[model samples]
Target: MSLLETLAGKGLRREPPTRDEALALLATSDDDLLDVVAAAGRVRRHWFGRRVKLNYLVNLKSGLCPEDCTYCSQRLGSKADILTYTWLKPGEAADAAAAGMAAGAKRVCLVASGRGPTDRDVRRVADTIAAIKERGDVEICACLGLLRDGQGERLRDAGAHAYNHNLNTSEAQYGDICTTHDFGDRADTVRRSRDAGLSPCSGLIAGMGETDGDLVDVAFALRELDVDSVPVNFLIPFEGTPLAGQWALTPQRCLRILAMVRFVCPDVEVRLSGGREIHLRSLQPLALHIVNSIFLGDYLTSEGQAGQADLDMIADAGFEVEGADVPTLPEHRREAAPARDAAPLADAVPVPDAAPVSGARADLVAVRRRGAGTELPPNA
Candidate 1:
């Protein structure tokens, strides 16, 4: 049987892909890339049909992180001038979350940047969680760095439906990305979240100068962790971060990575996160075939296509948003919406070289224009 056939069969059998099989999927030639996506699509449709889940991110707290994660603009000793802030008031968080909920997001991701949440931080977030839950049926997923002992349970009590702690990369490559913490620290958090009755939502970031083996390691690790949601972020390579100049992702490679994650963790919700616009460019629609979930609007530090554009993309691609029917594109959106990157440079969010993001918290109102011209070859 062809590899695709075997993979499709494995999906039907609810069997996970082996290490060799996953590597082969990643190694798929550029010419045969669409074929792999098609096979992964088959698996996706079998489990999720043409329904896409819309997720929205509420950056409850931004920047000022103590950890030194190389890819994160929020990390310590970083020069990216992204917004920094202390915790938002519960009402503010609820309001931010309401924007996403109104946009047809079925789940809202509440993210804060820090090494871990203290008891006070957890309680503060828990209050926000409770307020958001009180507002509607949206699922609450908290991405507040690491959780202290019992903090997950407290979050559960506060109405957090899921917990997000991305493994970021493989155990072997963990040190390259951030040395303040290790891979085991992340894994243990996933376990803690799962143990506390929050659905474990973990994932990885591709194109961070890791080997193919590192990608495979994370895919299999997610399976072992049995996470409910997997977000595959293509590294943004923000201009001021340590990885700033590392623009090694292509749309095809990004798709292949999503397909591999699907094959390895067939049933989980694989989301195309972060660098989709800068990296995926025109091919974003093709990704819907392999991933069931996506962030609806702006990402934590970067901007995404407007929510309407995302809804239109899902509808145009013949997929329905999870909680709402496919919306009809008005005449303006009917012809492709303007590429987010085409926006003027002044509109782009700049990760400034500064102290804690806390300094720029008030500048959140300064919207970055999503412009074009950032793509470079993997070697560039």
Candidate 2:
């Protein structure tokens, strides 16, 4: 069988791809890219159909973070000329959320920039969650960095449906990106989220100078964790961060990364998050076949594509926006019936050889001048 055929078959069966198979998907030639996507698209359809879940971000706090994650525009000591502000009041955050929901976003992610949330910060987010709930029905996901002993439960009690803390990259290379925290800390938080009855939303970022092996390692790790949502982010390479001008991803590379994640975590919600606009560029419509979810507009400190443009892209790509009433997970992973015959852990496999990556467009990264924490009207 062809590599794509083999991987697609494994994905449909919910079998974890061997490390070699995952790396091979990343090394496939650009000429074979569409076939790879078509194969993974089959798995995406089996689980998610043609529905694209729209998620919106409301940056409750921006900049002044203590953790120095190398790729983040908001990381401490970074000169990235992005917005920096204190937490948004509950009413202000509610207003921001209403706009995204009006544009058909089903989930509102409340994010803050910090090492982690303090007890008071968690309470503040609870109030913001309450205010956003008052506006209309929307799934609430809090992305405050790291969780203390009981913070996840507190967020859940306040009506949070999910919590996001990205593994960002492989454990082997985790320290290279940030040292204030470690990979074990991230895994612990995901465990905390799941134990607290909040849907675990963890994922990774690409184009941060990681090798193909690193990407595969993280994808398989997330699979083992069984996180409900896997957000695949491309590094934005903002002009001021330590990774400034680091452009390691091309459109094809981005697609391949998304395809590899799909094959590794076939049944989960694979979301095309940050940096899609710059790296994926015009090929984003193609990615709809791979990822079932996307951020609607504006990342924490950078501008994304226009919100209306996102809707148009979904339509043009022949996918429907997943409604708020629709469940994001397959029936087996849903909260109502959580039990399942857990698949046996795949055997340890050696990392495959690294794949060749191509050039990136340095001109594409744009700092956020509007949206939350700004005077200009926020994009939906």
Candidate 3:
């Protein structure tokens, strides 16, 4: 069988790809990139069909992180001027989640940035999760840095459905990104979350100056760890961070990475997380064919396409939003487009829940602006 055929067979069986098989997907020639994506799409369809899960991020706490993850704008000793605040109050967190739910998101990710949450911090997030649960039927995922002993059970009891901790790169490449924590520390957390009966949502960040071999290693590792969700984040290379000048990604390359993750993980939820807009550009809709989930609006510290546009994107791609009917765009509204050469989606809060409207929204103007690259930080 061809590599793609063999990989698809393994994916159909929900079998993990061997390291060699995973590496071959990454080594695919640029000329054959689309073929790889199409093969991966077959596997994606087998698992998720045409349904796309929309997730919304609630930045419960921002900045003030002590770890020096070089690609992050919020790391210690960095000078990025993103928002900095203590944890949001429980009601505020619920309100943010409500905004996402209004935009058709099925899951609310509550994220905080730090080494790990204290016992008290875990309770606070649990309270926020409880409040959000009280309001809607949304699944709650917590992205506090690391979970100490018993913290996962506390979160699960508080109504959290999952916990997110990303293995942002391979074991060989971990030190190049963050020295404050080791890769084994991340693996341990995933294990703890699973033991506590919480779904493990872990993923990786690409284009951090790592070799293709490193990418394959991480994909297979995620399979070995058996995480429930895998978020594939492209590096934003935010200015003022250590990796600011590393512009090594192209749209086609990003697609190849997503396809590789899909073939390796098979039935797991592969999310087109964080750097989708900036990195994927016009090909954003095509990514939906290979990955089953995307954040609904602005990321924790960065911005994204308007929620309406995201909804439209899902509809335009002929994919239905999971758990809700996709809203149809009126003919006149279809003619309206974001301002040409508009600003990047940053700093602006996502649209709050509002009444249904006809045509493109008059307030939905896109202008080109500069600052932090748009991103969705892993729930931590």
The local distance difference test score of model 2 is: 0.82
Q: What is the C-alpha lDDT of each candidate?
A: 0.78, 0.82, 0.78
lDDT of 1: 0.78
State, as a TM-score between 0 and 1, how close model 1 is to the true structure.
0.86
Error of 3 at 191 (Å): 0.5
Instruction: State the lDDT of candidate 2 residue by residue for 208-236, as single tens digits.
Output: 88999999999988988889999999887
Total clashing pairs for each candidate = 13, 0, 8
Which ranges of candidate 2 are over 4 A from the true structure? 335-380
Model 3 is weakest, by summed lDDT over 10 consecutive residues, at: 359-368
Per-residue C-alpha lDDT of model 1 across residues 174-233, encoded as one tens digit per residue: 998899999999999999988887778999999899988999999999999988789999
lDDT of 3 by residue, 102-123 (tens): 6667778999989999998998
Query: What ranking of all candidate models by TM-score puts the best one first?
Result: 2, 1, 3
- The candidate, 1 or 3, that scores higher on TM-score is 1
Better of 1 and 2 by lDDT: 2
Best by TM-score: 2
